[model samples]
Target: MKISIFGLGYVGCVSLACLAENGHNVTGVDVVPHKIDLINKGKATIIEKDIDEILLANWEKGNISATSNYKEAVLNTEISIICVGTPSDVNGHLNLNAIYQTAEQIGAALKEKDGFHIAIIRSTVLPGTNEKIGNIIAEHSGKKRNEGFAVVSNPEFLREGSAVKDYYNPPVTVIGTDSDFASQKISEMYEGINAPIKKTNIEIAELIKYVNNSFHALKVSFANEVGNICKKMNIDSHELMDLFCMDTQLNLSPYYLKPGFAFGGSCLPKDLKAFKTMAHDFYLESPVLNSILDSNESQKNQALNLILNKKSKKVGILGLSFKKGTDDLRYSPVVELAESLLGKGFSVSIYDRNVNISKISGTNKAYIDKHIPHLSELISDDLKKVIEDSETIIISHNVPEFKDVNLRFSNKHFIDLVKVKDIVPSANYEGICW
Candidate 1:
């Protein structure tokens, strides 16, 4: 297979060498004459671990070359990977001039070429970039998308120092393209890499890199904040973090990473407030820690707004507790949401088989009594009765009994926070964040 890479920077350099090493004839393309000259001379444009050796070896085998001619590069290669820079401005908006220019150059070059071409966006870009690139190519080359050529959002997840290794050992190779032809070609290109090939929606593939990097940034900031508190208390921060990393069940695993309603339960809300307040008491300013409660409150308000915007007189809460299969209502976010709806003068009904006002005691009983004094009147054990009486139903948990309530009650509007099922947002059903 023949491939052309658009930029000669870190990502492009590593991709060129690694792909060439995998027996693909990889051409390094750039507008800068010096960068192209360096690659053509069997020298890597950027300095990194093992890149110089890999590039030199591949060049000696005649599997790689560099050129400044974008037209020739696109015409000769089957796949053109766009590795251009998407630097941000002062306002944080991406300056996609390089990406767009490369698209135009590839489109114009494809005008004189025959056969199908695949353009892989290896650059980090926002959603809808793939569509824009496809439209640009269609307009410039007088050819239709997914027919004459196709665009794939194959975002690179290569870290700077370990790029060559990262390319070979990524967690997954996500190819976001609608065309089967392009997806197959791009998958074949990465066949030797040790990762599963996940073909996904184009926009999802485009935006996942941003999501990953942003989470990475959040992790660093959170660890630093924890380290600050540990230092203040004379605790071993490194040891604490090492122990924190070992918890695969909750701490270091995918337990609460989904996009859903506000987090509640007895522990998270109470301990987070206590921890951030303790940081304040120690004369330490933890912005990340402080901002968490505000974010949680905002999510609560988001749920409230979704219910109230429906403008229904009667509202039904499918699950009253913070989560499923639990009777603990102390500081439950759903309890807070129900209280807010009642305050807004809406008729509210609560249904939770696990929650029994008779069995409730101590802090749990006290919590519910203060929030909903008339719980016995509104609460019911019968699911059908609660759902049938209400005009708007808010499903809070992902229980099997609640997942298909809309299929049974076709007239009632459902606001799902747990993504109970794949629903088409009609008058009868809607998801909170899906």
Candidate 2:
């Protein structure tokens, strides 16, 4: 396969060398004469592990070359990968001038091209960028999208220090495009790489890098804060973190990664508060740790707003416990939500088979009595009665009895906090965080 890469910076340089090593004739384009000259002279533009050898070997093999002529590069290649930089502006927003300029140049070059071309955006960009690029190319080339050409969002996952290794051993190869031909071509280009090829919506492909990097930043901050507290306490932070990482069941795993309602159970809230208090007592500021509670409260507020936005006076809560298959009501978010709804003058009805208010005792009983004094009036074991009486139903947890309530009660609007099923039944269904 023949390919042209725009922007001979870190990502472009590594991509050019790696793609050529993968048996593709690659041409690198850059505005800077120095970068172009360096690549043409069998020298790498960026210094990193194995890049010099790979670039020199590929350049000597006549598999790779560099040029400043965008028209020549686009016309000679079957696909063009945009590796342009999307740096931050003064306001911290993405400066996309390079990406847009590259798109315009590719579109102009496509004007005289005879066959279909695929433009792959390997740059880190936000959502909706692919559509804008497609439109720009279509307007400039006077050709319809997916007919004369296609734009695919194939974001690179290369880290700078280990760029060459990361390129060859990417976690996943993502191809976001509407064209099957373009997807197949991109997938085939990465045929030698050992990674799962994931096909997804274009926006997801575009936004994933931001999500990944933000989480990475969060992880680093969290670790540093923990390290600060540990160091002050004369404890080995490394040993603590090593032990923490060994717990694959919860820590370093996807246990609580799902987007859903705010956490309100016995252990999470209590432990988090304790940890934050420990940090506070040590005269240490743990912003990331402290922000968790605020974020959780915001999520609770979000659920409340969703329910109130329905404008229905009668709201039925399908599950009252913190989670499904539990009788525990202490620190339950549903309990708090129900209390809020009742306080707001909404006719609230709850049905949780696990929770029997009269039979409830201990902290759980005390919790309900203090929160909702008139629990006997609002709570019921009859799911059918709750569904039949309310205009809007809130499915707080995924209980077996509430699985197909949407299908059964077509007239009632359902606000699913916990996704009741894989597929929703009605047009009136709303997920709290889909």
Candidate 1 has what TM-score?
0.98
Clashes of 1: 0
Candidate 2 lDDT = 0.93
lDDT of 1 by residue, 244-304 (tens): 9999999888898878899999999889999999999999999999999899999999989
The TM-score that candidate 2 achieves is 0.98
Name the regions of candidate 1 deviating beyond 4 angstroms.
421-427
What TM-score does each of the candidates earn?
0.98, 0.98
- Evaluate all candidate structures by whole-model CA lDDT and list the values in order: 0.92, 0.93
lDDT of 2 by residue, 1-434 (tens): 99999999999999999999999999999999999999999999998999999999999999999999999999999999999899999999999999999999999999999899999999999999999999999998998999999999998999989999999999999899999999999999998898999999899999999999999999999999999999989999999999999999999899888888989989889999999999999999999999999999999999999988999999999898899889899899999999999899999988988887768998888888899988889889889999888999999887667777888888899998987756456787888987
